[model samples]
Target: MVTEELYAKDSYIKNFSAKVTKIVPSGVILDRTAFHPRGGGLESDTGALILGGNTYRVTEVKFEGNEIVHVLEKLDGLREGDEVEGRIDWERRYRMMRLHTASHIIASIAFSKYNALITGGNITPEYAKDDFNVENKDLLPKIVEEANEIAKRGIKVKVYFLPREEAMKIPGVVKLAEKMPPELETWRIVEIEGIDIQADGGPHVSNTEEIGSIEVIKVENRGKGKKRLYYTVKP
Candidate 1:
């Protein structure tokens, strides 16, 4: 069964209530969830499920077809149809929100100023890394500096949906070097006003100012035309 994804509309939701739709050996499936599944290069969110006085620690969340599985530390007491409350680890989720937006800021700068395209990336609570299809690793320092300046502008970020045909027509709608947005009827577009716009699904901060600043912690040469930059966000 497809679960209602609460996070799709509002990333700030920290807690929610849902009924247990199913139970597997690994975890339980809720009819609705705010827990973000691990996908789109972002790590899964961890939290706890409350049923009565007992708490089940959510270790990892992932997608299984259309269903979102909330892996739990224990399943001895959970049953299908039971109601439970889900509490997101807000501290961790907030960090990811900041980092995710910072990634977009850096990426947009890299693409616009240097003609680079994102090859790959991963987002975690502590840090974020992105690989670019650019030859000059030296350019990353300038990109980070530019991204910081943009972050200070407090540009409002907007998320909306558009028809696939219409979205594909936009320039730079897909910045990834090797992937495209899932072939859905409508594409979710994340636009960092006046700076960048892309078809994305992961959660992000509502404003660039929330990112505070970005730091280039490390850089690597993946191969010809591929350079990776590791960075972290501070707020």
Candidate 2:
């Protein structure tokens, strides 16, 4: 059975209760989960599961088809049908939320100003790096400045689902040419009001202002027409 992914709808949900639906050597599957699995260039969330008065550290969270598997360090007493409390490491997850949202803002600016497309990207608690299809490295400074300016505007981030067909028609909704979102009937769309909008499945903060300020750490010339920008959100 597929797990209900709460994080897709609510990024701020740090704790949840779920019943074990299946168990394997690797990890356990829950009927519902707030745990964000490793996907979309973002790291999986780390946390602990409390069951029967014992705690199990979630070493990894991954997707097995539509199911979310919470890999544990040890599953000594876990069993199917057992109810458990899942609590995410908020500090780490919050950092990821900020970084992920910042990525969209930065990518949006690059696209608007230079018509660059996001080639690839990754998000971490400490920083985020996005590669864009741009030739000149000199544009990095201006893009960074504009991204920060947008973030400081306190734009409200909204998440909603739309039919795949309708979502595809929205301009600037898909940034990566090769990395399209899964062909689900309904696609989750994250929109930074008046700033950016994209078909995304990853968790993100609810406001651009929550990202504070982004500092460009490094700019790299990956190859012809490829520029990588590494940035961190200042607290």
Candidate 3:
């Protein structure tokens, strides 16, 4: 078994084709793929796989142990050794990338300004969210304005891999997770220059400027010291 290559990192793999090696209830397995599996609260890629002049709609992209699964609409004539052309819904993907990156910007800014720690997050094509440590309810309006300003500045967003030992040496890398992320020696790190950075695995926009209007839609106190923020970045 081999770990599937998550194409979200590249953010520019427009198309691909692969041979089917296995089939299951949710989706079929391909030798390779450009579709992203569901993880990190980001939705999976949805598109079409064209084979033998027939197109199978890919409804969900997921992982089964080590194999990448492409769930599809029931269609006739799918079998082993078949070659299929995969196409990603770029418009939707682009939105998700922007939203995902914006989440980082907000998280970075909030963490630094308030010395808060993130407890959880959820990202979707239309919007994204984060839970932060909050001291009082009076700060909602102020935090929202600051986050929107960060997005408007369009700071640089870059990705890089750090050696595990070297990564631990970095000032902001969190070593507190119950299980550190896998392949962290080659950690896919996201950096909003002069702002925020973290070990992340998901699609992101190349520049912070691409994140158009960022709106802090809502904020609520989930419990003691925790605040949840619901946000959407303008496309």
Q: Give Cα distance to truth, residue 19, candidate 3, Å.
A: 2.2
Over 4 Å off, model 2: none
Question: Model 1, residue 123: displacement in angstroms?
Answer: 0.6
Q: Best by lDDT, which number? A: 1
Q: Order the numbered candidates by lDDT, best leading.
A: 1, 2, 3
Show where candidate 1 strays beyond 4 Å. none
Per-model C-alpha lDDT, please?
Answer: 0.92, 0.91, 0.77
With candidate 1 superimposed using the best TM-score fit, by how many Å does residue 201's alpha carbon deviate from the native?
A: 0.6
Give candidate 2's TM-score: 0.98
lDDT of 3: 0.77
Q: Model 1, 1-235: lDDT tens per residue?
A: 7899888878999999999999988999998999999998899999999999999999999988877999999998889999999999999999999999898888889888888999899999999999999998999988999899999999999999899999999888888987898879999899999999999888899988999779889999999999999999876
Q: Write the per-residue lDDT of candidate 3 for residues 9-58, one digit (tens) a residue.
A: 68767688888888777778888788888887789989999986788999
- Model 1 scores a C-alpha lDDT of 0.92
Per-residue lDDT, model 3, residue 120, is 78
In candidate 3, which residue pairs clash?
Answer: 154-209
- lDDT tens digits, residue span 51-134, model 2: 877999998899887678999999898889999999999999999999999889877888887889989888988988889899
